[model samples]
Each structure stands twice: as C-alpha cells, then as structure tokens.
Target: MVKTTGFRVLWPACSLALCLLMLTGCPGPGDRMRFDETAQVSQQGDNVCFNITDARDYQPANMGINPRSTPSKEKNFNFSPGLTVADGKLCIPPSFYHFPDKGQFIIEYLLISKEYDEPRSFVITLEINGGHIYNVTPTEREISLPYCRYVMDNSVGTCQL
Candidate 1:
C-alpha cells in the first residue's frame, strides 16, 4: 500500500514534469508581440515636425505610457497618442524644430507600461539640431523604442536631413 501511494504521487509528478518540458519547446502566450519604433516627419514652413510611433499591439494589458520632464511646464509635451491606460500604445507627436543658436537639443522617448509598475521608467534620448531641446521620457512603467530617431526639414515639407 505504501509503495502504491508513492507510485501514484510520483506518476503525477512525472507527468507534470513531462508536460512542462513539452511546453518549453512551444511559444508562450506573451511571445507574439513585435515591439518597434516608427518615425513620421512632416514640414510646415520653417518649422519641422517629427512624429514617432511605437508599434507593438498584442497584449492589451501590457501597454501604457511613461513620464518625463521638460524645461517649460506650459509646453510640457506628453505622449502624442496620449496616455495608454485604456490603450497599449502611444504615438509621439512631432518635435518642432527651429534653427539652433548653439549646442544640441536632447529629446528623450520613454516607454511606460504596467509590466513593471514604477515611476520615471525607461528612457531613450533623441538629439535635435545640436541643442538639448526637449526631453520626453515616459512615466508609470518600462518601455522601449526600437526605432526612435528622425529629422524633418520644413523647407521642403519632408524629412531631408
């Protein structure tokens, strides 16, 4: 009777182990997402605008916006597509461009999500016109920008240089 009970317990354990091993070779439920960054630039007169979008839509529960800081509170820019508490992705608006007087402008792109709940999450920096202009980092959670750099020249209404 003791041996039979031990075998029964061991049988379930062995079956579970085999099932786990088989599952390891297959793709996970959360492994279907392909996160990447896309940049769209448009020019209006002397002002150049750059729009960056993050394309990763699979898990609705795994998407959101991060937070950041700026020099001007009145001009404090948030995610272009806005915060993603309801949605999982963010579309960053075009960063306006004016002739730089000196130095370089640094704009940061932050990815915010609930995967890791925290403040002031992941940061990606963008350099504009040799002046540290604007920084847009995400708040709330961690995110990434696979393709995040773009430049637009409004003199032609397109991204030239």
Candidate 2:
C-alpha cells in the first residue's frame, strides 16, 4: 500500500497550468497600466518646483520639456534639459516659468522597461493658472510594444498617498 498526500497531485496540476499560462500569456493592450512612477511638485510663492520621488524598476531616461501656451499661434517647443542625478535619481530643479493663466508644461521621458527590455515613453503634464498649479495629469498613453507596460505616474502634488 502506498500512502500519498494530496500535495503531490496538486503540485503537478498547478505546475502544468502555470507553464501553459506562462507560455501563452503575452502582455496585451488590455494589460493594466502600472502607475508606479511618482513625483513631487509644489508651488513656492508663484514658482513651481519638481522632483522625482520613486523610480524603482525604471531605467534612467532622457528628460524632455515641452512648454505650451493656450491661445497662442506659436507651436510648442521641445527641449532636453540637463537633469541632475542625486542619489542615482533624476531631478529637475525649479527653473521653468508658466503664465499666470493658460499654461501647460509637458514633461516627456523614455524609460527602458526592466522586464521586457524595451523603451516606454511617458508624458507628465502640469497645468498652471494664476500662480497656482492646478493639475498634474498623466496623458493618455498608447502601448505600442506588445511586451511593454503602460507605465505612468499620478500626482496632483497636493496630497500624499
């Protein structure tokens, strides 16, 4: 007579299922986006300051700053800023100025995916009005790569969660 626990039978079945799922489970457009990236933005006497809070599992990327003014015929201009690296984290000092009303600051960067080894682009927008920072929105991003994630950050910069 052989005495066997249920663990042996369940282990094989679970292993087989996991293997099949892994083989077939490729990242798709329906995959949930990971809003893990975070930043800190504050208004100091009509000046806005910005800093990156958490960048774990994200590769260092080139930072692009795009400033746009509403009701202006001039096209938006993009420029790459010299980002400061402190403690291996990227930081953008308070240097940009927005109008007292109707100004949009779009910060763009391409972070390399740690899991899929692909480049993922992100755009963080700061809407300013009347010496106040109103919204920090992560614009709707399209996931072009199959195995990459739609990684973006969410912060109004007024409260901590």
Candidate 3:
C-alpha cells in the first residue's frame, strides 16, 4: 500500500492548466497577424517572410506578392524596390518606386484574394512606411472560408493550418 499526497492529485490539474495557457498564448482563429518583410519584385532570392510573434501550426496564403511594371517600361523590368543589404545589414530603401534614371516608378495595383473564414476575411493588409499599397470583405470572408475549408478543391482561396 502507498500513501498518495495532495501533490499527486493537484499535479495533473496544474499541468493541464499550464498546457492550456501555453496553447492559448498565440493567435487563434479571428486574429490579425503582422509580417515584417522587405517587398521585392522577383520571387527568386526574395526574402519577404511573413510571420507572427510566437506562432506555429499556421501559415500565410494568397498574398499578392505580385506587382506589375508600369506601362512606360518594357514588360520585363525590375522597377519595384526590393530589400537589399547595405553595410552587412538588411536595408529597406525609402521607397518602392524606382527606375533607372527615371523619377518614381509606380505600379498601379488592385489587390484581391479568396475569402477565408478562419480569418473572416483572409484579412492581410500590406503597409509600407514610405510607398503605398486586398479584396474579400470582412463579413463575406468569415462565412466563406469555413464552408470551403474541407472541400479539397479551394476556389475562393488557400490557407495552411
């Protein structure tokens, strides 16, 4: 026969509470996440990483990492600004508007994405401190993604969780 003390009985409950706290500490459904990344034109060697503080088991999707060249230049031109390293450190230039010998190279864009429900809008807003820059309304999105989440073939949008 063994005598069990109160420590044994409370240990499980304390463990459970700790686990729950850890799990809920991060963003769950219907939370906004911010990504600090350098905006660039090309996908190759691009380092536009999107991440949230203390997050796992989730990812970003359908971000319009795409920007078209202004009509003035040839179809294939790298006018948009990209994050570059200067003095052995990451540097984001003052503007995304750039062209060879040309003043400000502007890219006119209207962003859109498939409605995601978990987010209620798949809401992703890109805010550039200097330069300027979604679709899927907050209301329409909340109801859409959850309905199509398990459909296998997602037409509205895509997300990994």
Candidate 4:
C-alpha cells in the first residue's frame, strides 16, 4: 500500500517536470512571428516606404487590437473584433510617432482567444527607429529585424481581456 501511494505521487511530479522541460525547449509563439523578409525602409527627403507583405501574410490569429474577448455560447466559433475586420485581418494601425527627440517606441499587440469559459491574453511589442525595426515577443525578449518598426502610441489603445 505504501509503495502504491508513493508511485501515485511520483507519477504526477514526473509528468509535471516533463511538461515544463518540453515548454522550455520549444520555441514560443512570438518566435514564429519573426519573418525572413527584408523589412528595410528607404527615405528620400521625408518619403519613407517599406513592405509589410511578409508580416501581414503570416499574421497569427488574434494578434490585433480589439480581438474577441468573449466566447459565444451559440453558433459556430466565429470571432469578431470591436471594429470591422478588414480583408480577413484585423487592422490595428500604428499610432506611435517618432519625433526628433523620441528615439524609441514600444508598440503593444494584444492577442485574446476564447476557450470554453476563459480568455487567453498575449502581448507583443515592436521597437522602431527611423529606418530600423525590431519585434518583441510576448516573452519580452527583443528580436531585431532588418528594417521594420512597429509604431505603438496612444492611438494604439488597449482592449480588456
């Protein structure tokens, strides 16, 4: 009887340890957002241009402003943002403005998904310079991209989870 009880306790502990180890070694969701495209912006006397095609293409679901926070008890699992969905992608435009004095900006992208009765929240940050851009994942780790900056300002407001 004592041996059986000890086995039961040890089994749970072993399972938990294995789960933690797997999570630590696996890449996170933010790591998946790192695209392999040139994100550089060229400026010609105040004219700036950059292509967001790669980023837009692999944009993970719920990675936008006003994502669906509540799950519906009825109907198919259709999600809706507070505003209209544009081209099947929720558009959360950058509100961060880089003034001459402001060298850095922290943009936040809140991701919320409903499962059963609870909602999950994930936050992503983007660091931007005049011609440089970096992506910060939900883990708060900084990832430097070649030429893309996420503009996060007051205009990029928060949504409740």
Candidate 5:
C-alpha cells in the first residue's frame, strides 16, 4: 500500500503554480512602470496627445492608450487607431465619453519598437482646470523618471549598461 502525505501532494501543486507564475511573468503589485519625462503632452482639439521629444532614439510599437477612473475600470472612447504619430509625436483623439474634472490614463508601448520585448508602460495622472491640463503628477515613486531610468539602466539582470 502506498501512502501519500499531504505535504507531498501540496509540494507538487505549489511547485507547478510557481513555475507557471514565472513563465507567464504575471505582473503583481510590485510591478512598476517606467516613466517618460521626454514625452510632450498637450490638449489638441478635444483630445489629449503625447509625443516623445529629445529622445529621438526610441520609437513605439504595439502602442495603445487606456483612459480610466481607477486601475481596474477602463473607460471607453470612440477613436480609430487609438494611437498615431503626427509630425513625430504620438497622439490620440479625444474620447466621446464625458471626463471628470481630472483624468488618468495609461499608455503602453514597446520602446525601440521591438515587438517581442516587454512593453514600457506608464500612467499619466492629470488635473484639468479651465479646460487645460493643469498638472501632470507621478502616481508613485517608482514611476518617476529618474528612478525608473536608474532601474532600467543599472539593474543587474535587466540592463547591461
């Protein structure tokens, strides 16, 4: 007769779960996004637009934008080709949905236009006053440009430079 201990059964299951988690690279609370200080943000017509200036070396791929009131809720808008580059800047049309006095959005893209690489993502938290962008604030410490740049360029396993 074979006896299976509870520990033995749980160990295999736990190991498999951990392997799956690593392989998927699932983002958790600790996952932090890199900020783009070089991005030029503005209100164009009824929409908000973005472009990366000074850093001509980086191009975006698989670029998309999501406007939201909170992390889990995605707001809808009517726009074809959600993101576009005009005169060297990435831009998006205004959402038909009504926005609050302030708005928050996320832009995700692959830096250097590398389709296979993990996308660089950031949150743009803004406060609108008198129909203009009054403030662009960092949501957290890690998403600040200086800190993110250090991590991306100096992290032992992530960057060779």
Candidate 6:
C-alpha cells in the first residue's frame, strides 16, 4: 500500500531530525549566554577579593559542560580567583587564577556537547576607593608573605587610586 510505504520513509526522517535537535540543541535568545566578563571583584579595607562568575552558556541545562573538572571540557569556565593586599598597591602576579572543579553531569542520560570553546574574557578596572593594588599569575611560587597573590601571570594588570 502506498500509505504504508510513505510511513516507512517518514518515520526514519522524523527520527533523524529529532536526533539533530538534541545534539545541536535549540537555545532561545535568552538561552544564549550574556556578557562574558572575566573577573568579578570587591574591595574590603586594605585587601580585595574576587571570584569568577558562572561560565555556563545559555544552552539547555543539559548543555552545560562540567567547567570545573580536570581534562574535562568544563574546565574552560575557570577564572582567576584574585586577591589584592598590601594596601591595593599591586595586581601581584599580573595574571588571573583559575580554580579547578570536579566535573559532574547533572543528568546521566544526556551527553555534553563535543565542543567547548574557551569562555568569554574581559579585564575590569575598579577605583580602589580605599587602597592600591595589582594583578598576579597562576604559577607564581607560594608566598611567604602574609598576603596572597597570583602566579604565572602574563600581563601587568593594574589598579587605580
């Protein structure tokens, strides 16, 4: 029967479309990630503390890659955990710190997208309202000084009075 034959072809086509949708995902406008700024900072007395914002894109909750695990695609969300002290006189290591996380998939039934491009990054300038400061890197040797700093930093990150 012609109707039966059409159903045979139609079934497979519909199934394939469904699979693609699941893979690429259908992110609505709000689903797309917003500004990807790098460091989020705050100042208290003579010291400043900052942490990276959530790096997950606006994709479906299932689409989020485990940004905190080692060798996992989600490590891409790592941001510098910067702290400034000694009177805000230095940005220290000059580079930002990236905190590592153990990746955990919220849903075992879903697969993370194969692609994990680096997250968006930006430099921020803050008026030191009460102190002086500088940036630091990730690989700098441990500090003997009471204050903390960054290591392997690549730039002369700055602070303002």
What residue runs in model 4 are displaced by over 4 Å at the alpha carbon?
Answer: 1-88, 94-104, 109-116, 137-161
Where model 2 places Cα greater than 4 Å from the true spot, the runs are 1-40, 44-47, 56-60, 68-80, 85-91, 94-102, 111-121, 141-161
Query: How well is each residue in 44-127 modelled by candidate 2, as lDDT tens digits?
Result: 555455554444455545655557433224434334344443443444545543344667776556655356654545445677
Q: Which model, 5 or 6, shows the larger TM-score?
A: 5
Winning model by TM-score: 5
The candidate 6 region of ten consecutive residues with least summed lDDT is 103-112
* Span of 10 residues, lowest total lDDT, candidate 5: 151-160
Q: After superposition, how far is residue 10 of candidate 1 from its true place, in Å?
A: 1.1
Scored by Cα lDDT, where does model 1 land? 0.37
Q: lDDT score of model 5?
A: 0.49
| C-alpha lDDT values of all predictions | 0.37, 0.51, 0.31, 0.35, 0.49, 0.33
lDDT of 3 by residue, 1-161 (tens): 13466778878999999999898886675565432222222111222222222222223322222222223334333333233333223222324422232122222221122442332112222323332221121233112244333222222234345
Clashes (backbone N, CA, C under 3 Å), per candidate, total 17, 1, 3, 2, 0, 30
Predicted candidate 4 versus true structure: per-residue lDDT over 42-125, tens digit per residue: 233332223232232233233232212222232132133242222333333333222232133322232233433222222333
RMSDs, each prediction? 12.1, 11.0, 16.9, 13.7, 8.8, 16.2
The reply for model 1, stretches above 4 Å from the true place, is 26-132, 140-161
**Candidate 2 similarity to native, TM-score:** 0.40
lDDT of 1 at 98: 39
* Residue 156's lDDT in candidate 4: 32
State the lDDT of candidate 5 residue by residue for 1-161, as single tens digits: 13568778888999999999999898876576644442446777777666554334345445444553445344332224345455766655554333455555544444454434443443444456657663244444414454332322111112123
Candidate 6 wrong stretches, greater than 4 Å:
33-120, 123-161
Candidate whose lDDT is highest? 2
